[model samples]
Target: MPTPSAPSAPVADGGLFCELYWGTSLAEAWSYGPELGQVHAAPDETAPLPLYGFTLPEEPFLLAERTPRGWRIHVPPSARVEKSLKGDAFHPVGPEELTGAPGRAAVELREGMTLRLVEGELRLLVQPSVVKERAGRFRVRDVAWLITVAILFLSAPVAFLTMGPDPARLAANNARALQVAHDKEEARRKAMGLDQPLKPLTEAERATQKQDGGARVNVPASFGVR
Candidate 1:
């Protein structure tokens, strides 16, 4: 996932050239890899501007250009911290479904990972790094989703197969037998308790219990085993 080498050397009226590609989805094009933050920056005379509070990766993230200070990323106070944690299945910040942004925009996910957006769509700069890493190591991304779906898909048959055995079948039959046995035991318990006086129940507990036939069994005092 090599970036197309620095478009040019550092300039004063510092021009961070970028080629970004935003789409209805971040991954629709190229730039926005699956991470925290990617911010585009330009020189401002007055204020030390603030950025959104998306956190950065703990490890050294891929940066398009290296600074003389080495690959250093900054987190700003004004940066808006996300409502929830990252990798939450979808973006909490977005509902717009915007594809890309074009400018000297400094885009970042909740990580120190920074990309210098050269002139173009930010999508271009966002290489498929995470996808690449996952793909490179174990082809996890390629198969992960399928593996998950497969597990879910195979669940039905696997469950059937597990129960397809003699032991499981026997166990299941025994479970049914036991259930009947338990029901008979429960009935006997009710019969035993019926001879006793009623017990107190909390108001809420009694209210709920009343819905399901109170006290497990509500035989009248006069009723006998006969």
Candidate 2:
């Protein structure tokens, strides 16, 4: 007869190594890595295993608590953080989005470690990084939009020059101006009673109303009407 054995614990390979610092002095240093089948923290390797918390990497991808200094995780500049649960997709994790909590805020490191901030004592589990694709500066849609805007900006002056001013509109404006001038002149003539055709002066009328050729005026006529 064969004897059944107990299930063996799961193995943990890597986790975030957090070192809390105050000013230039190191306050605390802990490594959150997998030990056996559960997540645990160690001051070193021989330290006692304390069960802290659990994280569902399949779900929201994060399990964290608030700290006094807020959620401040230092990421290496050379490494980029990406996230994908189903393993086929991944996107670059932005700095703002990395401040995650109440949701998945865990980031995958390039060196095969998963990093997350936690409150209280440190506890960690191993989750491998999965990012097969990388993004560049400009996408196809972005480049197309930029090109369209540039074309519009550059062609504005050329379009304006080519179109010029409307000839029909200018002619209509000139005609309206001429009509306005004619109407003004006609109104003035009507007001002065000179709008009608003039009649030629008769000889008697002209003789009676004729002015002297010299500068001298008739004294009686100049002084009083007669």
Candidate 3:
């Protein structure tokens, strides 16, 4: 039998930079673990403020372990940092309660990249992807979702006022009501020019709606019936 693999070292132990807030955390606060390259939550090693909620600042730095004691972070001393890293940690190690896994596709996001998380990592193929460009003619899908959600939220009062006596009746009518809402939403989407695929207008479709005659349109009611 293979010499019993020396009990595998814990993924993180005494010291090393570790993210406390995980990804909810901004990229600016990852701190150095005094020893194991884990995040230092202790003051003597981490030194500063915020007894809890402390994390290593995310930036290039030299992380070294202190013997007998725990980890110590060498942060470029600053007034703001002095303010934040100025407290003591109750637990010698950083908070153990947090074993947070990454969100959606746990992929690390470089600054400004709007990442779509896939199976427990940042969706690959776009690692060093470009930051999102500003709004242009078309609203992106996320923007559309936000707009739809707002509309639904504003409509909540209407929903509450219209709820009937029976919960079952409410449930029974919900699908039809939702279907009607869907249809109305579709119509609104079309009016905003969002329902159609985006492409240059076809020459045939752009052909004169007037026969080059007067300001009046030459469109037959039958022409647009479909």
Quote each prediction's TM-score. 0.16, 0.32, 0.17
lDDT of each: 0.38, 0.46, 0.37
Top candidate by lDDT: 2
The true-versus-predicted C-alpha distance at residue 144 of model 1, in Å, is 8.7
Counting clashing residue pairs in each candidate, in order, gives 51, 1, 37
**Candidate 3 residue-wise lDDT, 1-226, digit = tens:** 6676554223223223222232443322333332332222232435432223223343322223243333233332220111111132222212232122321111121222221211221111111212122235655987899999999999999888787377888788998899999999999999999998879876776776445556665787668653
User: Which model scores highest in TM-score?
Assistant: 2
The local distance difference test score of model 2 is 0.46
The candidate with the higher TM-score, 1 or 2, is 2
Error of 3 at 79 (Å): 26
Ranking by TM-score: 2, 3, 1
For model 3 the local lDDT of residue 53 reads: 27
